[model samples]
Target: MRVLHIITGLKAGGAEQQLRQLLRHLPPEAECDVVTLTSPGLVADGLRADGVRVRHLGMSGNRDLRALPRLVRLIRAGGYDLVHTHLYRACLYGRIAARLAGVRAVVASEHSLNDAEMEGRRRTAGVRALYLLGERLGRVTVAVSPTVAEDLRAWGVPRSRIRVIPVGFDPALFRFDEVRRKTARNFYGLPEDAYVVGGVGRLIPGKRFEVLVRTLPHLPAGARLLLAGDGPEKEALWRTARELGVADRVVMTGERPYVPDPGDDAPGMPDLMSAMDVLAAPSAMETYGMAVVEALAAGLPVLYTAAPAVSDLPADAVPTAWHVPCSAEQYGRELLRLYAAHPGERTVPDVVQRNSIQNIARQTMDLYAAVLSDAPLEVRPR
Candidate 1:
């Protein structure tokens, strides 16, 4: 079947990363294509390397209507069997374009939705109306977490139309390797004996990354902050580090791919995780903490403020995952405690396998089949 994936820009973030990872796991026989409505950065490059056809629509902004006809034309020409849309802009335009192109099966994912926010932006009445209007044109909507599912319901979407499908991680890729740990540290120019504190995500304000930077002052002399993604907040984070007098200790690896591109020199997510002594997620709110789960898969003890991926599971299954209040002092205290206690001989937790990408991929394929056949989702959410 020919499937076309549409997203708002191909920048490296949770939603974009999930799109690439899901496509990578799909069957080889299924023809797939990707179109970015705007900035086609590192992720676009990575997707193309994976042999996925990618296009940039060159959308000037949110108000650009000319791109709609172009997208419809491309969809019609591609003869796609399914059109899956991600992010807000893509959902609104791609759904309409897919319908215009005569595609019957359409899928949209609500990757970010919490009590107060959607897509990292504060929720508004106008946004909700627009989202609902576009949602009606699609057959089904996939929520990345139970919280998002509930939010969709609250947003007036029928419960029957929403299926909760948690973000997934590849367990095998994150298994801790001592050799890889050494190599990754060497590659990143990290000192062999430093106590590295890791945080992974787009360096956005919602993520509260500055909390980690502020915690640097409270940490021991050899402690370091290693951030794995990039966004508008990069320079601000550097400025924060400078003011805190720990700029040299803060290592910002701009926009590394979670699933490595085959020939790329930059270290992949797994290698970076292997180099961390502990993973700190200072985000005040999260829908489904993909990075926290990835850290658990790497056998790193995680201290997080809000992570549905860790919290939704039974406590026994995620012993390594600890919830902390959103504060630098708390994070610093937790870091010191973990340092003294000496956690993880690189032992992965049981929860890692629960949200395994293989299982998620199968569920996703089942979802696609259900939508295509116009059947109700018999979702087995893990």
Candidate 2:
């Protein structure tokens, strides 16, 4: 089976990373390639190194009308058996292009639903209309979480058309290592005895990373806040840290470079997680908490706020994850308690069995086969 994956851009984001992981585990019989609607960023090089073909559409802007025909021509020329799309813009354009190119099977994945998309009732009508149109064109719309699937149904997508597929991660990549942890702490200039609280995500308003900054001052003197990711809010977050008089305690590691090596057990996120005492995800909204799950895989306790990806999971699946209130004070209190508890690592064999890239890729390939056969897409309950 030949499949073409379409996405807005190959930037370092949850959806983009999920796609790369999925591609690495696809069945040998399945031939897959990727096409980015805009310029391929850091992920392009990694995908190429993995022997996956990547094409850039050079979409000028949101109103670039020429991109539609260009994508249609590319799809027709590629003769892919199916087209799978990720992100909003890619879903909108990919569905239309696949239809125009006479590709009967098209699947689009919905990764998130932010507040901006649904501020007022009337404002969402246009967005819902576009989504409904895409659902009509595509064979199926994959939701990364059950909450996301519910959101899709609320937006007028038929229940029959929505399939819930949780994003998967490689446990081997995030396995904890003591030596690497010490090295990583030294590399980042973090004191070995300091209590480290880490947050991994884009430094944006929606992520609510400022809450972590606010919580830092309330913690013990040696407590440090490490944020791993970057965005437009970097300068503002730094200013907030200074205003709060905790500038020296905050470390913002601008976008960590992702080096994808399936077999090589080298230091990356595993070392970072090992060095940290706990992971804090204070995002105001999260469709799926990829970082939270990865932290759990790394055997770290997590204090998160309304992470549907983690909350929706069965209690037995993630015992280490604690759902906390969004307030910084509450986060600080919980961190203190958790620090005192000094939670030990629990075996997360269930996480590896259910969320490994291999299992998710197999499930996805099954979905593709079902789509081709016009069979019902079974929603796997966790």
Write down the worst ten-residue block by lDDT for model 1.
Answer: 373-382
- Per-model lDDT: 0.88, 0.82
304-357, model 1: which lDDT tens digit per residue? 999888787778888887899999889989999998886547778776787777
Taking the tens digit of each residue's C-alpha lDDT, what string does model 2 give over 1-382?
Answer: 8999999888767788889889988988889989999858757767888899999999997679899999999999998999999988888899999999999899988886644553112326777787688779999888888888887777777888888888987888777777877987888888988899999987778788988999888898999998888788999999999999999998877655346355533335557777788999987678888888888877788899968767786787777788888889989999999878865764454564467888888879988998877787765432
- Candidate 2 CA-lDDT value: 0.82
**Worst ten-residue run, lDDT, model 2?**
114-123
Q: How many pairs of residues collide in each model?
A: 0, 0
TM-score of each: 0.96, 0.92
Instruction: Rate residue 215 of model 2 by lDDT.
Output: 89
For this target, which candidate reaches the highest TM-score against the unseen true structure? 1
Model 1 RMSD in Å is: 1.5
- Which pairs clash inside model 1? none
Candidate 2 residue runs with Cα over 4 Å from true position: 114-123, 257-267, 343-349, 376-382
